[model samples]
Target: MPELPDVEQFRTFFHAHATGRTVRSVEADPTIVRNTDPAALDRALRGRRFEDPDRHGKWLIGWTDGPALLLHFGMTGDLVWSGEDPHRHRHDRLILAFEDGNELRYRNMRKLGGVWLAHDREEVAQVIGALGPDALSIGRSEFGERLARRRGGVKAALMDQTFVAGVGNILADEILWQARLHPRRRIETLDEAERATLYTVVRRVLREAVRSYDYVGRKRSWLTHVRGIPGGTCPRCGTSLQRATAAGRTTYFCPRCQAADPAVGSGP
Candidate 1:
């Protein structure tokens, strides 16, 4: 699924190409990933202009003369800009053609993501209401407040949309590793200082992700580089990395670095 960072990258691309552009026509082929009726989408978006680049959690909100388009790139969805439509990609669920003859394609290989049209602000709020504060924009105090309220494993809490939106599997793992806290570590066990550090780590990791265009593989300082390695070793401690399922997602951690139990000498 496209997390906050990947969505941030998409937001950047949308701002550069799609924002403030007048729509000439609309195309809907959500035979694979439809949220609203294709005809309804076309009716609402055609001849309208996209204004106000807004995103919350993993959802992108695009405003038009009619309804706002709400987008969620589930697993394998992305936006591509094409000067000319060569009829190239078959998985484009939504295509918006601009007055300038440029094309914006919302392509999803697996077709798991969805696009919805919001007829009013209440509708948009309903779509966004299910999500927690966006991981990137939440304040440090708010992060700590929310983290303090989680009643499950730290990883699961981080992944929960109702707890903190946009911090998905990879980001949770990376942030936990940076904070030297195990994925399974219970939130109640975290101290004010530890939680504060985690807040800093989450912001740092998320910012780094947006800065690198979701290319953590190219960064040596990122623990994501070693995540799920065939014979992965912790870059910080050189101990062989361990993996397990947390919140139903494959989680990576260093046993020597982030101990299983923090009460009994959890390593710093």
Candidate 2:
């Protein structure tokens, strides 16, 4: 799934290419846009002009004259921009041709991504109502408060969109590992110092992610170096990195660094 940083990059791209451009045409292949009815989409967007694009959590909103078009890129979905041919890929769920000859395409391999037109602000609010404060926008005090209130594992809490929007499995593991907080530690067990450390770590990780374009720690960097290596030894401690399941998602953490509260450790 495209997380906050990836979506942010997409927003930048959309803002530059599609905003203020008149829609020349709207094309959709029913097989690719499984979540929306094609006729309704064409009727709503074909002749309208695309305004600014906005993002909340993992959802991308493209504003038109009336309603906003919402995009959720489910695992393998992405947007492409080209100046040449407008139509090429079978996976292109939605295509918008511009008057300037440039085109923006929404493509998805798995077809799990979705699109919806929100006729009013209330509809947009309802779609993202469950999301907590955006991880990047929330303050330290508010983040601490939310962290202190949850009793689940810190990793699971971070992964929960209702707890902190925009954090996914990879980010949850990276942030917890950087803070040296075990993934299985109960949230309420965190002291003031731990909470502060987690908050700082989250900010640092998110900033690094934004700067690097979602490729954080994917290279030789400390966090990225460890995360991409399966069955690899911990970078800080030599103990073998552990893999387990939490909240129905695969999680990775260093046992020596983020080992569970010695008093409450257990296998998944």
Candidate 3:
């Protein structure tokens, strides 16, 4: 799953390559773009100029003349840039040919990715209404206040989009491991120091992720390095990493570093 880091990387790429360009053409193959009708998408975007691109959580928003295009990269979706022919990838569901002869394509191997045309920019607010403050943008005080109110496990609270936007399975696990907090620890149980640590870890992890290219899992030093490596050792503690499902997604944690808290073991 593309987390906050990956989404931010894509946003930067889009802003550099596609923003402020006039759309010469729009193409969509129904088999690939699952959520959007081909004809309607084409009618809404063709010949319009791309205003700017923005991101919230994992959602990518590209503004046009009237409607805004929303892209949700379910699991395996990505954007590619090429000055040559654009139809090189069979998975390319949405293609925008610019007047400058450059092309930007959205490719998704899994059909789970969605493309929605929002008639108004405010529609984006409705689509991601559950999202809390952006992980990168939230202040330490605000994060602490939000964390103090939650009763769920620490991992669940971080993973909840409503609690903090842009934190996915990988980030949640990495942040918890870095903060030395067990995944199942109750949010209210965290002291002021622990809450501050959590906020710092979240910002640090996201900063490192954004610096990496495309937020792809290509770097060995990244948190993605420990995410699903079966029997992988902890990067900091040198102990074996453990895996389990928390909040319905696969989670990784350093058992030695973040021991299970008895007090919060039964939390939501």
Candidate No. with top lDDT: 1
Please, what is the whole-model Cα lDDT of each candidate in the order they appear?
0.82, 0.79, 0.79
> For model 2, what is the error of residue 161's alpha carbon versus the real structure, in angstroms, after optimal superposition?
0.8
lDDT of 2 by residue, 1-268 (tens): 4888888888898898889998777777676544357777777787788888998878888998877778888878788888644456877788877777778988888878667768778888886678898887889989977876788777889989899888888888888888888887788788778889999999988878878854755545455566647677777766788888876788777887786774554233
- Which ranges in model 2 have alpha carbons more than 4 Å from their true place? 31-36, 84-87, 214-219, 262-268
Model 1: CA > 4 A from native: 32-35, 84-87, 266-268
Ranking by lDDT: 1, 2, 3
Which candidate do you rate higher for lDDT, 2 or 3? 2
Predicted candidate 3 versus true structure: per-residue lDDT over 84-178, tens digit per residue: 44455988888888888889988888878667778785776776567898888899889877877789788888878888888878778778877
TM-score, model 1 to reference? 0.94
Residue 9, candidate 3: alpha-carbon lDDT:
76
For residues 1-268, what per-residue lDDT tens digits would candidate 1 score against the true structure? 4889889888787888888898877787756435577777777787788877787878888877678888889888888889545574988878888989889989888767678778889999987777889899899888877776677788988898888889888889989998999899888888888889998998888888888865557677778887877898888978898989888999889888898776767555
TM-score of each: 0.94, 0.90, 0.89
- Higher-lDDT candidate of 1 and 3: 1
